[model samples]
Target: MSGASNSGAALGSLLRQIIVWVVFAAVVVVLPHLFTSGSSISMMSQMGVFILFALSYNMLLGEAGMLSFGHAVYFGIGGFFTLHAIRAVNDGVFSWPLELMPLVGGAGGLLFGIIFGSVSTRRAGVTFAMITLGIGSLVESSANMFTDFFGGESGISANRVTEVTLLPFSYGPQIQVYYLIGAWTVFAALLMYLLTRTPLGRISNAVRDNPERAQFVGYNTTMARFVQFALSGFFAGIAGGLFAIMFEIMTASNVGLIQSGSVLLMTFIGGVGVFFGPIIGAVLITYMQTALSGFSEGWILYFGLLFVFMVMYAPMGIAGVIVAHFAPWRAGQLHRLIPVYALAVVPAMLALAGLVSVIEMGYHLSLAYDPSQPIDLFYMQVNVTRLLPWVVAVVVLAVGVALLKWVSGRIRERWNDINKTTERPEAAR
Candidate 1:
């Protein structure tokens, strides 16, 4: 009876997992239909690419406890190689399906990961991070030196629509490209998720938590880390390949510090503690990058402020905060915190509005200052040359901050109440 019940439970778990994946695929398929625009399709494709890249980074930082500042090395290398492959196909030098080109990029990344991981994985922690950074710098510098391959500053370009596809349709359409990226994104996500259930994945986690103990238990911690790093490179390379296909270009910047930093920001802001954290992070950050940059020159400033806020106040990230309420939800105590959250949001929005006003005025003064021109603030023309608007904005910001501080205390108290109530049942059991 016990064995049968265990088997039944396992079957149910598998069924639930299948349903979740199906739903995820459904959402990916349905999204393009809802947002039927060329730019939206393009933006979603970029999101899909970053989602894979961020998830791969999470495999190192979150699961294997290896923080990488140079992960983009693999991404750029893979992209360049993939573009070269596409060029080869376009030139009649080879006949291959473009759909499988990302695999070639994966192979390139895996090869380099093996080459680099052997040395970098020798030491853990800051040493490993610094080594990766150095390696990235070396590769980036080599890009200019190897002009034939790297194309110097112009970079490499290729045509993805080489009439080499498994389907009858040419992948020239943005929607088609979106589907290709979506397919790979789902495929890579599943493989990464499955990796977490494998022996290497478990050993990687062990090495992450306590390298000494992992070594004591007859596991080569360095080897496990190397494997994890290489696999991460493989996935990152896949993202790079998709990037090549989508943009038809691979440049030095793709493998530079900025690209590496962008992925790091995505993974960290998404909450490296959870599997789906990077997904949320990638989607949100990508939207901000694509949308917010169009509206203001200070979007980078706003982005930085957001990162700082997440690191300081919500270290667990957006997903982590959402996950934290699950216990209370299960125990029927979540409603207690809803009103408090609603109360807090009002002051938060007001504070954000005031902050935006100040930032916009500052940008107007420094970037495109003109006494005759008025900057738009909250849908109204505001003269930065005047003092009253500044004073009003400052006052609003001050008031909002003060109110938010007071409300936060109440929020804390309510959370304490909910946590206690939920824990009592577990304690009694």
Candidate 2:
């Protein structure tokens, strides 16, 4: 009877996961058609790029337990190749379809991965991270110095309105690009997830947990690291290619330390232990950047603070926090918490938007104009007002945030109580 019950529970869990995934896929597929707005589509496409980048980073940090500081080198090189491929396709030197441009990035990543992995895989832990950091810095400095290839600070741009699109759609249309990106995002995510189930994937975990134990069990730890690193690079390259295609531009910024660090933040904030955690992190971080960076000069500082807090308080990430509540969400307790979660969304969004606006206004003042430019707080456009509205906004934001925190705390307590009750019997057993 116990065996039968366990099998039934496992089947139910699998069905729930499958259903959730299918719903998410359907939403992604239908979103472009529903929105039809250029800006919306473009933002969605950018999200897809970040999703790929974050997932690739997770392959190393999550699966292989390798902390890479130079992952951007592979991604940047991939972008460069993607741009070149676009140029070649446009100039008739190559006869590939526009949809296939990402392959160029993938191949570039694979080539560089093999070269770097061969050396870096010899060392693990802090040594490996330092080596990658050094390599990344070297590549970035070379990019700046070699103006001939990298186009200096101006970067390189490619025309996407080419004659090579596989479908009847034009690349100029944002909706069409969104669909393409959405498709690619799903495909790449599926591939990466499948990879975690392979023999190499299993060995990667072994190497991550204890290299010495893996060696004792007759595994070549170096070989395992090398393969995993190379694979991670390949995925990062694909992400870079997606970025190039979406933006139609590639710059040193794409492959610099900042870019690599951002990917790390996304993965770590998402939940390194959970497969879908990084994806959630990518989407949240990307959205925050897009929404907040425009309003505040201090956005980076705020982001840094948030990251530090997460590292200290919620090391498992936002997903981990959510999962903690449901414990075994597959058991169906998650459904009960939906109302409480939904209740927190509105106040949270309002508070966040207010904070972002204040930040953006401050940023605009610093970057664009001095004290001469009139600060605009409410509407966000340039105005002749002084600091009165800004002061009001700050107070409002503070109060709103405090309220949000209070409400969230209550919800969390309730969730914990329910979860504790559910787990008591299992613990006693």
Clashes of 1: 0
lDDT for each candidate structure: 0.92, 0.84
Global lDDT of model 2: 0.84
User: Candidate 2, which segments miss by more than 4 Å at Cα?
Assistant: 1-17, 328-420
TM-score of each: 0.98, 0.82
- Kindly list the per-residue Cα lDDT of model 1 for residues 1-429, writing each as its tens digit: 999999999999999989988998999999999999999999999999999999999999999999999999999888998999999998999988999999988988899999999999999999999999999899898999999889999999998999788988689999999999999999999999999989998998898899999999899998899999999999999999999999999999999988999999898899988889999999999999999999999998988999999999998888899899899888998889889999999899889988998898888877784754897788899988789988989988988999999999999999999888888888999
Displacement of the residue 188 alpha carbon in candidate 1, Å: 1.0
lDDT of each residue in 189-260, candidate 2, tens digit only: 888988998999999999999999999999999999999999889988988888888888889988899999
The alpha-carbon deviation from the true structure for residue 54 of candidate 1, after best TM-score superposition, in angstroms, is 0.6
lDDT of 1: 0.92
Give lDDT: candidate 1, residue 291.
97
Clashes (candidate 2)? 5
How many pairs collide in each candidate, listed in order?
0, 5
- The 10-residue segment of model 2 with minimum total lDDT is 376-385
